[model samples]
Target: MQIRDLPYPDPGVPDARSGPRFLLWLGRNQLGGQLRSLAWGLLHFGSIAGLPYMVGVAVEAVLDRSGGRLALAGALIVLLGIAIALGDTMLHRTAVTNWITAAARVQQLLARKTAALGSALTRRVAAGEVVAVSTGDVEKIGWFVEALSRFAAAALTVVLVCVGLLVYQPALGVIVALGIPVLALAVLPLLPRATRRADHQREKAGRATELASDTVAGLRVLRGIGGEELFLDRYRTASQEVRTAAVRSARMWAVISAIQVLMPGLLLIAVVWQGVHLAREGRVTVGELVTVYSAIMILNYPLRHFEEIAMAYSFSRPSAKRAARVLSLQRTAESTVSRSRDGSERGEAMAPVMAQPPADDSLPPTGDLYDPATGLLAPAGRLTAVVCGDPDEAGRLAERLGGHPAFDDAVDMPSVRLGDIPLDDLPLAIARTAVLVQDKDPVLLSGTLRELLDVPASGAVNPEEALDAAQCSDVLDALTQASAGDDPMTAHLTERGRSLSGGQRQRLALARSLVTDPEALVLDEPTSAVDSHTEARIADGIRHLREGRTTVVLTSSPLLLDRAERVVFLADGEVAAVGAHRELVHTEPRYRAVVTRETDAERVVDRDTDFLTELDIEETA
Candidate 1:
């Protein structure tokens, strides 16, 4: 694949069985690119191989006093120079292209996986590991993949040089041939120790990176809790451990490098000493002696590749393993709509099923959402609220409604269905079209306000209407204040809406979700960040906007719950009571305790005021 064709039309499924297998798969898929790189590598190394042969011919011509031969040598030198220049340039170009194409392919695979898995990606793998694999690890994998062709060319050059030496002089050839293998194998013993150190260093480094990422993401919270120094200290310790491991790894490689140099230098000495002896005995010409020595020196060039290829393989092996692990993760069947209601495959049945789109003929099952785990049913056309003592349980229920897997239960747990289709058997389109679930902590994608609200959806709802229904006037005001543009919708937001307060981000997320206008919308604490006044307005707006649509809001806020047509009170993860907000509050004390967490001081003031009023009446009588 060309570098420009990057993000290959189809990255194709990776062979994620193991690290070596994955790398092999990458090489096999990009055979054309690797071959191009190999062709250029041959030209470049071939030019170097020809240089020594020409030098020896030149030496003989000068000794014989043949002007014609000397002139011929001069012409050959010029041609070789041109070859060297052209070969070097093209070789570099192809090598870089190979690197970029390979890296691009891995990046595409990672991006696709991340998009398919969504939030589960982070939960399955550490966020830092994901970042590292997509960035640094991808480059390392590409580096090794690109280096393979060069290493192959170098190995071929070494074999050719040895053959030439044997043809020129038998005694010197035998010594040179025997010495080259020693040079190659001398460093093999050190590799295992070196690879072990590298692995240790990489593990420590990954931990350090994970800690730093966590620290930065939660920096605001750290400062609020006065624990910034604590985390800083932890990060420092982690960084030091990474440093120590790196130093140890570096020392091992240093020893290997010393051996690489020492072994080749010894071979150079052997070829020189042996060539001189053969010359003195009249068994080899002086020109032949020069040639053998030059060939041995040139052997150093290809021999160094032994170390380079080894190091590349060592580093990339672990990187490929990490990347493979990520690529292999498939969304649990419970977390997404099944391919078919009857357990038949809908698409190509790819390993990571989410990467494939559902069949075009598929349609969503018709009915309200029912989560058997909690027995919470959001009827077809009404605003329903769920109040739970535990916020986490409420959040899980919201996720299940939107097709996310339950954290505590087995994926095969039996589930209720709508229209003969089990919740697990519903097509993906059902999750995308039939319901839209907004998490308690919704993310506002980075873009202008209009783009944020214009995400692809099946329904066509006006952006202004949704924003208004979510009570997002303050959000627009904040964006207008932050931007130079006059239109608030044109104002750009920072990543995840970092430019806005928590309440503004929540409102914007709510507005974006509302604009989808799904058949059913599940919102978990949609107005939790806003004050009671703004929340009351939002509750009224939502009720009016979703007048005849299925809306489920999971929250305990009285202002929100009071507006719901019906409320479902959850206790210990089951539906304990179901009624209107006021009726449940009076009938279920457990529900009242959860929804009403008013401060004791506020209640004490109410009682004291009642006692003073009674005393005033008594004094007046």
Candidate 2:
């Protein structure tokens, strides 16, 4: 079947509920497959029950001195064997089908939830947790769901077998019937402990996965700072912790398995001993005793399923909880009112539309992008630079401008309006379209240079133009250097852009954002990776390419600020000062200090007054 046609079972129900109730919800949705599986299981088990009776008849006929009846009984036994074989094959086929379908359903649900959460997912849930839920949790959940029908059919077979035994011989039948409940109920106490251990193991696994993801994402940075070995050691430690948890979980399951096997063996021994006594007393015939013994032996299949159901439930419950948590993440809020022909909200008539206005008018006029929380306004159409001494405040401002949920009023945060518009009222699509924030480490998806530059909402800007704008001409040359005669335009990028250098990947990401040509582009130190020459070129190219568009550059780089129409120095996340680059250099001491550090010559000169004096004396001579 096609992947798109796969079923998606919801994992979120109520928290205060039993596992069976949750299972019932899944079963009800997939009744046809479950019923078919159930039918096959019953048929197979019924045939198994018939075997003991056929054997008992053969024994009776051989002992009775009736040759014709013995032949007839032998023939019936052969027919029953054929029936058992046919039923067993069909049972296996149906059960496996149920398992595959259940696995598909869980996978579909996970994929759907991931899509719904979008970028918010990574912010809310750890990347490792998400990876664990999709790969490991889906399988465990499917195992439990598929096991339910088989368990039900096995239970029914046990009941029918017990009833048949009672009709054949009441005294021995009662003993076999009494043992069924004991075998099933014995493992219930062990379930809670097993489940707890499984939960712990799953949690540890997720943490380990998250640690690995973080380490891999920042591998370049770690290596640059000579901390690759340190991070690798940390990951190894985390992996060992996961291994320990897994072993602890395995130990609990081992105990439960021993009990399942040992209890059934003891039950078989008891039934056999009781049957011999009955035969000695001459109260039961030999054939009837054999039938009772055979039925008790057959009880093993159903009892084994009881153990499996317990194990499946123990593993699946936590997985379901994790899937539910992902699904429950809310999307960004939008207005209920429809948009007008002019792209304005139909319900409200507050602001007049301007001529040749910015692509998205949801952002206020006068170019004043305000965040009420910190009382900051980034005036429109001007090159506004945010200089935060605190890195976290800069991050917060960048998130707000990008309309991330943490700063967005609609997503469990305080109602801090942006300009006069309620941040939530503005359409999420429009808000995102208006402002594009490029993080320091933006993701570079696997694609050719041409494909990377053609990002979301980007018009047909020539690949050459975008590459030049982001100062990626050298990066393109570097790709050719790495591989002889490799087509820069058609070269295939590996997953997560692993094939490229860190600086190359970063520049490509910047080019992609520039290609989008958004009304307001928010770049957070977009040139932190590239050389000084490339950085200056990018700064110049950005000013030229986005001459009319509102661009906000978050950097302490004086080379970039030198081209800005206005620079807003951010102190403790507030707009400390707003003016031209040269003006900030002369007026703000903090700005001067920050910009002075950008030049290595100034740092060396500041360190040595003798060097400065020698330069002045040589000029005078």
Candidate 3:
């Protein structure tokens, strides 16, 4: 079957029994290819078994002093050698096909699961665990699945050889049959302990990989805070732990390997010793003794497979368990549609109109946005500014307004009910269309200047107008300078917009969000990266551009606040007082203290200085 045709199993509820069962299922599903591979394996192993029998015939012919029969025996040996070489080539070709196909299937499943989980995956499973499952675990699973058929064929070949020995020379045959199992099964008891060690090693390796990934992602911040060396030391310590775990895992396998070699050697010696005794008693001819020895020597191939199968199991079981854990994470509950206000078509129309006022109850209250959580309502459809004394309270209020699930518990207790409307129930495509959040450090993907400004879903505004509204004309000029006008608007950006300065990247991200022009826009410190002059221009432009739109800006910048129609002072994360910028400056002492950074005496002095400076500048002009 094609990879695309394989059914995608639900990752959130992976069947615990399915990992091992999948091998049987795959064999059944791809029975034709499996049968072809098995046929080749049998043919290859059969040819090998026939060689020892042919050698015995050649030795017997030499002992009989029969020249014609001796010549025929030599010809038979030559033909058998050619057959073994041909079979071995075909065997390898088919086995590799089986291995590749199995690995491909596992990879396809992993890709589907990643797509299904989306953003929720990172919140639930460790990034390193997912990486390990996709890379190392998939290959190990394929190795075990492919080994099953080869193991079956090897086992059959050994049985055939033992049966032939029993018929040709009974006493020596019994010893051969009994000794093979003892060597093969001896490694079985050590397998459980070996597997446990391997599992522990894999877990430690995954944790180290996660730490490395996190460190790289945050390296810039770590360095800025002078903690880079400290983090590096911690990572080095984690690396050493992984190394120690790996050594412990390797030691266990080493013991298994020693046993695999030593047991086979001892078995070989026992068979040789018994064959010598039987020959002296005249119970077996010299040629028969040679055949028994040859079969015993050939038993190594099957015995070696026993060790390999044990190893495959030890690796695959824990890997499957890890994969299962990732698939078991639950998705959030979907939203439910409420009944219309009336039973008429007008009611149907009115229901949507009313719902628009609160399209997503799951969304937390922004600065002026009403949240039913704390019984505080920032009146809808008006510009509202929040002034919070505690930065932590402001951040928490912002998170609640954003409808983060972690803040759901704080809903509907004089605060807004963000969970009344099921977030999952709202069509993601529709919910995102209404509410757009512009974070402080919005991620910028590598692309041309024009492409970077294109919003994810809708493209309503003209690109140039959006850029102008965001006061990013200078940013556009910089792009042209860098690109030399060959393709200024289409110049490629580096990953994460690394080629652009921090403020430039921030402006571009803002322009991209503005282009979307959602019904409600919540911006958290959008102008924090820009200079004071640019910040003032952006604040004035935003007020003009978003005249009729519901826009919420979270910032401590007085420049941005001066443009707001209403400002709400938040003390300890709740509404302490609310008014226009000038009104709050007079009424709320804490608000005046925060925004003006002054005591009453300093405020009067600063006010006089501001009045005199304005009058002097006017006279000079």
Candidate 4:
């Protein structure tokens, strides 16, 4: 494929067998670019090698007073010079293209993998490590892939030039051949130490990065607790460790580099000394002596590629391994969507994973969702409120209801089903359309206000309607004002709506979720950031917007619970009581204690205030 055709329609399924294997896979996929680069490299280096021969011929022509031969040799030298210029230029062009495309391909694969894994990826891998992989690690892997063709061309040129010298002069060829091998193999012993130091440096930097990310994410909280200095000091310590490790790695590579230069310089000195001695003894002509010496000097350039090849591979090997590890993380079967869902396998005409289409043509099953583990049946076409004693249990239940487990494998647990069909049995896309879960913390994507609320949905609700239902008029005004009186729908937002307040961000997220208008919508403390009055409004809005649909809200707030058609009181993650919110409050003391959280002293204080207010009213009368 041409460079212009890149960002391949499909990056192709990665063969993530191991680090070395992954490198091999990347190389094979870009074989066309690699070959073109190699061919150009050959022409360039070949010209440099041929220059010495031409110089020798010109020298001989002048010595013999052969004017015609001299002119021919001079003209040939100019042609080779032009070839050298063109070849080097084109080689560099192709090599860079190879690097960019390889990195792009790997990035696409990681993106697809991230999309599939969602929040589970961050749980399995660190946020900083993922950042490092996509940035520095990707570049290193691409560098090695680009380095391969140049090294091959250099090695081949050395071999062909050596053969040419052997035919021209045996005595000098033997010494040159023996020394080149020594120069190539001399630094093998130091590579392992260099690799270890580099690995240490990379690990230190990743930790520092992760720590910084965490600090920034909770910067407001850190400032409140007066811990900004504490984190900064820790980051400083990590940065110092990274610096020290980097210096150690550089020192090891310095020794290897010194060896590389020292051996070649020693070889050059030897070839020159021998050539001068031979010319003095009348053993060889002046032209031949000049050719041999110049050849040794030119060989110096190609020999450095050996060092480059070693260094590039050393850096890229670990990077490839990290990339492979991330790619190896598989989504659990229930959460895994087929490759075809992303168009990754469309070009290959690949068969479906199941051979036959899923039953129901992958459409969402229609019915009430039942969780056997908790004995919670959210009946079809009603609003169900679940009051859990523990907030953490409530969050996990919200995830499980949508076939996603917050902390464990959903496949290993009892499968949540809809209308007699296990959610696990349906494709992830289908299941997601069937049940949409909005957790306590929902993120808002950055884009225009219109784009932010535009998502795949039943198309029954529009962005404006969803915003109105979520009581986001203030939010719309603020965004429009921020955009300098642009259309409210055209107002832009920042990442996670950082410029917006917590309550505002929450309302916007709720609005976006509402736009989808799913068959079943599950919310966990979605109104926690808003005040009671606003929460009451939002609760009523949800009740009206989700009428004739399956809506499940996991919260204990009186404003929200009082409006539920049915309330399930959960203690120890199981149904302890099921009735109307008000009925359960009087009948089940445990439920009342969990929801009200009022102690005996607090209850007495409330009674005293009520009596005083009554006495004042009576005095006024």
Candidate 5:
């Protein structure tokens, strides 16, 4: 297919058994493109190889003093030059097509895998590693894939040239044939060293990328702790180490390059020296001597291709392996069983959940959400606030509520059910629709506010209403003002909403979740970044808006807890107390202590604000 026709209709399923295997799979799928590239490559290199022979004939024609013979050689030379020009141009185009298509296919596969794995992909692989794989690694992989066909053509040209010499001049043929193997195979022993260094450099680079990402993400925290300079110094050290590793890796490759040139030059010297002796003895003619000498020089061109293919493979192998490992990740522990070989019954997991048809859009088992492990039940069509002391446990429980594995390797874990129907037994689409879990750090993808809020929502809550409930009027104003003439809905956000404050990003994310308007929504510390007043407003909005939906909140906020219809205080991973927030505050000391500490924290903030206000008022006077 042409470059415009890409990114392939289907990238095709990959073989993730090993890195080399993955590379093979990519090439095998693009056989048609590879063949086209190979044809062009052969035509180009064939012209280069044919040039020396034509020059030899021209020399012979001059020595013989024959005008017809000289004119014929000139005509052939012109034809070969034309072939060189056209072949080289087309070769470049086909090679580029292969490169872009390969990269596009890998990107699509990575995207598909990432979507399938969801948040678990990052839990298993570092965010930096993923970024590296999707960006830099993809380029390296494409480089090798595009090099394969050219290398094939170059190697073939070398073979045919050696054979032509054997037929035309047997003595020189022996020398060229013997030297060709040495030139090609001489770098084999050093390649292992080169590959190791490349791998080490890549590893160091990945770590450095991860460090930079972390430093940027927490730059504000570093400044708050008076450690920004310290972190900066650490990143500098990491950066220097990466540079050092890259330089070391480059030095090795340079040595290999030197070998490629030096060995070929030495072979040319030997061939020319021998050719002169043969001419002196009258055993070979002057035209043959020139042919042998110029042929060695032409051989140098293909030799560079050999080194390039080696270098490309050395780099792309590791990249392909990293890509393979990510693609191998499964969304669920038992996904292999749920999906059929032909994908005929890909949604087989939902068979148990959808045993009978339903009249409404909602799936069957439309009742309370019950986590078997913690004995936590969120009653249907009500707001339930869960107070957990440990944030990690709260996060794990929230993930479990949506039928997702809390830990990276969690398997055969207790299942959460929608009443009698197991949530994990349903297809991802149904499960996601049934229970929408919004973690505290919800990402604001780069797009206009309208696009960000445009999701597969239930159509119950409009973006305006959700934004109002999320208390994002200031956010809209900020976006609109920053975007100049653009409306808030059309105002584009930068990646991760970097332009917005933490409170604004959180409010916008909350607005997006509210827009989805799922039957059951689980929010983890949704109001943590917002002020107490805004949090109170959000609490009121949620209560008024979600009048008949299942809303589960995992937070220790007193205001949110007070507004909840029923509060479940979890201790030691199980429900320790369940009642109205007022009843729990009055009766349960464990529950009351948690809420009291949060309330005290809010009061401290109030006192600090008041002190600042008083100092400002005095300064104004």
Candidate 6:
């Protein structure tokens, strides 16, 4: 395929059987490109193969003093030069195209897999590994694939040259032919060691990359906790390890390269020595001796390709294996029968304790969200609050509600289903239409505010409405104050919205989510960064805006909890209690401890306030 035709709409599923098998599969899929590359490769290598013969003929013509034969040889030389130039240029173009298309195809497949697996991808594979596979690994895989045709051409050229030499002069040809196989196979014994070193280097490098990626992603938090230097030192150690491994790997390859040069040089010398002996015995002419020498010298060029092919395969095999591991991760139950729909009692856990139609002018959101794992059910057209003591579990739950199920090895774990449909089996379009999960730390991608808020082609929620519902007036005010004469919607944000305060970023993300107007929305600690007063306003605003939608807010805040119609208190990842905010606080001690978290000083203040209220009542009586 051409470069312009890149990024195939459907980069079909890759064969993840094994590293070598996967590489073979990639070659089979790009047969047309490989053939084109092969054709060009043949033209290029064939021209080089023909060069020695032309020179040998020219030497004979000159020796015979035949001016006409010499002129014909000169014309043939010119023609060979032209053919070499065209072949070289076209061969480069085709080889590069094959490399690019192969890399693009792998990238597309990885991207598609990433989108399909969503948050579960990183859980199954390290983020750094994913990054490595898509970037460096893809190039290596493509490199090996592109080199295949060149190696084929080089092998063919070597064979043809050997046959021609044998026909012209069997005595010298025998030495040349024997030496070729020895030169090619001489490095086979050293390859295993070199390949092992290369594998170690790649492993160290992958770890270093993963460490760097994690450190960078958590830089903001690291600085807050005064652990930046600690992480920097850790990364430095990792990087040094990678460097040492790479050096060792390079040294092995360097030895192999030296051997490649040494073996070929010795063979060339032997061919010349034997040719001279044949000439002395009157068995070979001066022209034949020169031809034998030139042909052996030409053979060295194709011989180098043998080493390159080996190196390429060694590096790419591990890369293909990594890509296969990532592609092989199945999203627990999303691919097959859903854990929730497997006729287990776990499904009952997701049954809604109460179902109520929304009271609003807006249309009610579609679908019921059920977390079979925790038995947390969010009925249609109502606001539900999930109070979890553990923020990490809360975050994971939010992810599951958005059709990205948690991938775990436990057989007892229930599947996270949406609207009675298996999350993994459902198409992305339908999943997106069903729910939108807003994380506690949502990413604010670099773009204009307008672009950030734009969600697909939906017109259900306008920018003004969403911003106001998310209580983003303060965010806009801050942006306006930061840059005068700029529209809030048109203002640009830095990566991850670093330019905005944590509260501002959270509100903006909430606004973006609101614009999607999905059938179900899961907000995890959405207002944790804001003040109590702003949190109260936001809670009221969220209730009003999502009046007729399925909304589940994971928060311990009293204000938000009071606003939700039903509050499900989670203790140790299971439903401990379910009731209204006031009732749960009074009846459930664990729920009260989790939600209130009041200290002794706060309790004294509450007692004093109550005493003053009683005194005021007595004075009124």
* Segments in model 3 whose C-alpha atoms lie over 4 Å from true places: 2-13, 16-40, 61-120, 155-169, 333-353, 356-421, 426-441, 447-456, 483-486, 515-525, 539-621
- Estimate, for each residue in 1-621, the C-alpha lDDT of model 1 and write its tens digit: 676666688889999999899999999987887888788778777778788878888899999998898889889978988887887788788878888888898999999887656566676799988888998899999999988888888888888888878887788888888888888888898899888888888888888889999999898899999999999999999999999999998999889889888987888888788778878889888788888888878778877888888998888998999999999886445434332221111221112111123345355555555665566666667899999878888866776777665534435434544423454565565656766789888887788988898876646668988899888887888778889668998999999889889998999898888888887789999998999999999999899888888899999999999999988888876677778889877677788778887456755776698799999999999
Candidate 1: regions farther than 4 A off:
334-365, 406-410, 414-430, 597-621
| TM-score against truth, every candidate | 0.88, 0.80, 0.73, 0.88, 0.88, 0.91
What residue pairs clash in candidate 1, if any at all? none
lDDT of 4 by residue, 472-584 (tens): 98998898889997688888899989999999999999998899999889988888898998889898998998898888999989889999998988887666778888998
Query: Each candidate's lDDT (Cα)?
Result: 0.80, 0.73, 0.69, 0.84, 0.86, 0.82
* Residue 31 lDDT in candidate 4: 96
Q: Write the per-residue lDDT of candidate 6 for residues 1-621, one digit (tens) a residue.
A: 799988787778789989988899899998988888778777878888777777878898988998888888788888888888988898788888889989998988888788777777888789999999999999999999989988888888888878888888899888887888898899999999989998998899899999999999989899999999999999999999999999998999999999999998898888888878889999998888888888877777888889999999999999999998887776555233334332322234446443243343143324577777777777778999999877788877887777666676324555556555545455576666667788788999998788898776257888899899888997887777666746877777889999999998999999998888888889999999999988998899889988888899999999999999988888777677788999988787777878899666776787799799999999999
TM-score of 5: 0.88
Q: Which sequence of candidate numbers ranks them by TM-score, best first?
A: 6, 5, 1, 4, 2, 3
lDDT of 6 at 555: 96
Query: Which runs in model 5 stand beyond 4 Å of their true positions?
Result: 335-365, 419-427, 476-495, 598-621
Local accuracy of candidate 3 as per-residue lDDT tens digits, 209-274: 888888888988898999999989988998999899889989998999899888878877887898
Ranking by lDDT: 5, 4, 6, 1, 2, 3
Model 4 bad stretches (over 4 Å): 333-362, 372-375, 569-577, 586-590, 598-621
Clashes of 3: 20
Report, for all candidates in order, the number of backbone clashes. 0, 1, 20, 0, 0, 2
Error of 1 at 545 (Å): 2.0
